[model samples]
Target: MASSTASQQPAQVWDESQCVAALAQLERLQAQIDDLRLTIPRVVAPLSPQITKRPELFAAFKKAAVGSQSNIKAFRTTWQSQETQALFEHTKASLEANSDLTPGAQLPRYGWEQKEIRDRDAEARRRDGAKDGEDKAVVSMSKEERERILQEFRAANGQLKVFSKDDDRDILIHFISGGLKYRFHVVVNSETNGGEHLDAECLGNGEPFVSITRCVSLRPHANELKPLLDMIAAYKNVQSNSCAKCGKLLDKSALVPTARRSKQPEEANEKQETVWEALHESCLD
Candidate 1:
C-alpha cells in the first residue's frame, strides 16, 4: 500500500508540471499571434476584386502616389537647409495674420497709449505739488505765528493755570509740545491764564502738530493717549466726528460741554475748572 501511494504522488506531481508548461506555451503562442495581428495591414489589398474592378480607383491611387513623392522630396529639401526655419516662421506669421478677423487687430490704438501716458504724468505732477505745498506751508509759519497759535489754543481751551510746586502742569506742557514737529518749551507763569505756556522754537520742514500728544488734564485716569491718537489719525483722513470709544458716527450738534481742572482757584473754598467738551451723542446710548 505504501509503494502504491508513493507511485501515485509522483504521477500527480508530473501531471501538474505538464499542465504549467502547457499554459506557458499557450500564453507565448497567444502573444505572438497578437503581435502579428497588429503588424498586419487592415486594409484590403489594392489589387483586391473591388478596387481592381473600379478604373477610377486606380487613377486616384496613381495621383496620390505622385503627390506623396513630391511632398517627401519637398520635406527633405526644407529639413536640410536654414531656409526651413525661415519658411516655418513665415508660415506661422501668415497663419497668425489670417487668424485675426477683427479690424485693426495688428497694433494697439495710438490715442489710448497717449492717454495712459498723459494720465500718469498728471498724477505724478499732482502728487509732487501736494508734497511740496505741505512742506512749504509747515515751514512758512514764523515763530511769532506758532506762539500766537499756541496762546490762542490755550486761551480758548482754558488750559493755562498756576499750581503748587508739586503740581503736574509742567509735565502736561511737555506732553503737548512733544506732539509738535518743532521743539517748543512750555512756560507756566502768573500772566498765563492757563497753567501752561509755550516758548518760541522752530519745527522742521514738516506739518506742525502732526503728532498727537497726551492731554493729561483731560481724562487724567487714562495712562496713554494712544486711543485718542488713533482716533485723531483716522480723523485726518475722513473728516467725520466719530465716537472715540464705539466708533459710532456723530453729528456736530451731538457734542456736549464737559469740565476740566483749572490752574487756580478764585475763592479759598472753590476750585476752578475749564468748561468745554465734544461728547458724541451716540456714545450715551
Candidate 2:
C-alpha cells in the first residue's frame, strides 16, 4: 500500500520548461508595471486643470490610477511560496520518472501561452468568424438609436458640427481640439460594402480619411466618444510635435513624426492597455 501510494504521487504532471518561461514572462511584465506606476500620473497630473473642463477626461485619469493599483494587487498572486521554483524542479523530476506515459498523450493547457502565440490563434479565429454580421447590424439599428449615439458624442464637445448623409446608418463628427477644427466619419458598418467614409473631404482637403482602410466602431451601447476624440488629438500631436522613431519632440529634419499609427507591445497591460502614442514613418523599417 505504501509503494502504491508513492507511485500514484509521482503521477502529478509538471513541466520545468513552462515554469521557466512563466518566470521570464513575469519579469518582463513586472518592468512594464513599474514604468506605468511611476510615469502615468506624473505625465497626466499637470493636465488636471485642463481636463476638468471635460469631467470625463479627468475620470479617465482616475480610472488609470485605479488600474495601476490593481496591477500591484495582481503581483501578490504570482508565486505564493518562495519554494515555487524549487517545487517546480522537484515536481518535474517526479513527472519525468513516471515512464508509464503514453506516446500521444494530451497535455493540460494553461493560459500563460506567449502573446505572439495567442495573437496568431486570435487572428485565425477572427478571420474564421468574419461574416456579414456587421452589415446585418447596420440594417437592424434604428434611426432613434443612431441619433442617441451621436448626441452622446456631441455632449462633450459643444462646438461639434455634426452632419451625415448616410441615412442614419453612419456618422460624421466635426469637433475642435487643440484650437483646430477637425473631423472624421464613422461608418456604422464599415466597408459600407465598398462605400467611401461618411465624410467627403478629410484634413487639408485630403481624400476621405487618414487611412486607406475602413475603421468602424459598433458599441455595445451609446457612451461618450471621449476616448475616440482623445485618440484623434494624440494622432495630431504626433504628426505635429514629436518624432516617432526617436520619441523626441522633433526629429533631425526639425519636424514631428509625419507618420501615424500605434501598435501595442507584448508587454502591454499588466492592468489595462497603455495609451497608443504617435510614431515616425521611417521607423516602420
Q: Tell me the lDDT of model 1 at 125.
A: 53
Candidate 2 residue spans exceeding 4 A from truth: 1-145, 158-160, 165-167, 176-180, 186-201, 206-230, 233-245, 249-255, 258-276
- Tens-digit lDDT track of model 2 for 1-285: 123334435444445444435544555455656665665666467466566666777677777767767666665544443444445444555565665555215322222334224334434543543443334333234557556656665674466666756665555656555465666655544344452223222344311132211121211121223344434434444334455457686443233343344445456566654345544432323
Leading candidate by TM-score:
2
Which lDDT tens digits does candidate 1 get at residues 165-204? 2232221222222233223223232223222222221222
Predicted structure with the largest lDDT when compared to the true one:
2
How does each model score on TM-score? 0.16, 0.30
Runs off by more than 4 Å, candidate 1: 1-138, 159-285
Q: Name the TM-score of candidate 1.
A: 0.16
